[model samples]
Target: MHRVGLTGGIAAGKSTVAARLRRLGAAVIDHDVLAREVVAPGSSGLEAVAEAFGQEVVTVLGELDRAALGAQVFADPMARERLNAIVHPLVTEAAREREAAAVADGSTVVVHDIPLLVETGQAGHFDELVVVDAPPELRVQRLVASRGLTETQAWDRLAAQADDEARIAVADVVLDGSGAVSELEDQVDALWAVWADRHPAGSAR
Candidate 1:
């Protein structure tokens, strides 16, 4: 299977593009979904996380209290790193398992929708790295509106990411997300064609 890593800055419409790829018949493994799954209620991941961050990070119902955990980690670089150290490997492992299953099922192309693909320096693992591109201001605006983050909070999160130039520099495919949704759709449709041409019948989309 052709492993494509799809990534973008926060609020850059990565999920929208990923969903479109799925609708077009590509097998997509959403890293965010796998991130949640790895830490679900009684999983070993949750146990490790609670051990690392204390039980306060877990809800009464035993699921991770994401908001509380975010609050603790986002403001502190060390805390964020600590959390990621425990979480990222588990998420990555689960994602690999999912990808292997898709490949076994005869998928021709498998896309991993990952937000921190560049930040983690894992882009080298993929056959293609597709980045959803948008201006920083647009990213901030989208984050504020969609995620309810304050301007300062949005900037802080953006500050934590590699700059747009850095991200675009490494992209094998750049999907411009600053324009209308229809524009993004065009990019994805064109990308689907390219993938089909490159992989022939082995790929799903």
Candidate 2:
């Protein structure tokens, strides 16, 4: 399948772009969704995380306390590295399985919606990279409005990521999501046209 890597900073509308691609017949694998699945209550992923971050990070329900862990990693570089060491490998493995399954199912284009594609140096995993981009100020505004994050928290999340220029530099396709949904959909459809022509039988690597 034509595996296209989709990514953007927090609240940059990567999910919006992914949904548009899905509606246009692109098979989409959301990394955030897969990440959560990997760490479901009794999963080995959770156990590994607990071992890395300690039992205090695990909730009474046997799930990871995401907020607490986010606080830990976002504030401490070493802690984030430690957490990534435990989770990144599992995410990568799960992503590979999902991608392989999608290809086997005859998907024409598989879009991997990963928020940390650039930060994690996973840009080379796909046939092409598409970045959903917007100015940092707009991203923070969207985060506050949509996710109920305070202004400070929104900026903090954005600040933790690679800058907009760095991300755009690596994008083979850049979708500007600072406008209406229809505008974004048009861009998605445009990309789909290219992908369809390139990988008609879903045989792209």
Candidate 3:
């Protein structure tokens, strides 16, 4: 199977590309979804998070209070690193299982939708890396408009991850995310064509 890594900055339209890839028949493994699943109410991930960050990060209903936890980590680099140390391994293992299942089910293309692939030093794991890119200012504008983050909060979020230059350095393909949705979709279509050609269905890996 062809393992493709999809990543981008916060609010840089990576989700849009991932959705298009899903619609176009790629087996898309969303790490963000797995990240949440690993930390569900009864999970060891939740227990570990509570052990490190405190019980205040867990909700009354036994779910993780993501916003509460995010507030603590986003402001402190060491705290963020601690959280990643707790969560990244779980997410990676879960993603591996999902990809294996997809390949066993005859999926030729497995797209891993990872927001922090670059930060995690996982660019080499994928057969090809696609970086969805937009200007920092535009991403900040998007965060403020859609997510209700303050300007400072948006900037802080961006600062927590690798810069565009760093991401681009490892990318095999870069999709522009500063344009309209249709434009992004077009880029994904072109990308899907290449992936499909490289790993056609029912062909040998």
Candidate 4:
């Protein structure tokens, strides 16, 4: 399979690129989805998180209270590191398993939509790394406008993620995400065409 890693900062439009790639026939393994799966209620991940951060971060209904946890970790580098240490490995293992299943199912192009690809040091695992590029300020505005986060909250979330320079430095393809949605989708379509040419369907790699 042609393993592609897709990543960007919060509100930088990585998910939009992944959705476009999905419509273009790439098998997408969204890591954020996997992350939630790994930490689902009654999971070892959730148990570990509770053990580390206490039950306060978990809801009465047994799911994670993301807002509570984010409030704790987003402002503290060490706490965020601890959270990553707990979750990243689990997410990686789950993603690897998911990719294996996709390959077995005859997937030729597999795009892993991982928001923390650079932070988790998984960029080298992909055949191509696509970073959706946007200025932090623009992303901050997007978050505030769309997600209802205060400007400070938006910046705090961005601060929790790896900076643009780090993501761009490791990127094989950088798609501009500062423009209109259609423009961004057009960039993804262009890249997907190149990828489809390189990894034709039903061809043994």
Cα lDDT listed for each candidate: 0.88, 0.84, 0.92, 0.89
Candidate 3, residues 1-205: lDDT per residue as tens digits? 6788999999999999999888888889999999999999999999999999999999999999999999999889999999999999999999989999998887888899999999898999998899999999999999999999999999999999999999999999999999999999999998777766766771332
Look at candidate 2 and give me any clashing residue pairs.
none
- Candidate 4, lDDT over the whole model: 0.89
Per-residue lDDT of 147 in model 4: 93
lDDT of 2 by residue, 1-205 (tens): 4678999878777888988888777788988888898888999999998888888889998888999789888867788878777777898899889888987877768888998889899988789999998888998888889889999988878877888898999999999988888888888888777777776764232
lDDT score, residue 105, model 2? 79
Q: Predict model 1's lDDT versus the native.
A: 0.88
Regions more than 4 Å wrong, model 2: 201-205
Model 2 lowest lDDT segment of ten: 196-205
Q: Single out the weakest 10-residue window by summed lDDT for candidate 1.
A: 196-205
Ranked by lDDT, the better of candidates 1 and 3 is 3
Clashes counted in candidate 1 amount to 2
Distance (Å) between predicted and true CA of 167, model 1?
1.7
- Model 1 regions lying over 4 Å from their true place: 202-205
lDDT of 4 at 113: 95
| 33-76 per-residue lDDT for model 1 (tens digits) | 98899899999999998998899999999999998887787778
TM-score of each: 0.94, 0.93, 0.96, 0.96
Q: Residue 96, candidate 3: how far off, in angstroms?
A: 0.9
lDDT winner, 2 or 4: 4
Task: State how far residue 97 of model 2 sits from its true place (Å).
Answer: 0.9
On lDDT, the stronger of 2 and 3 is 3
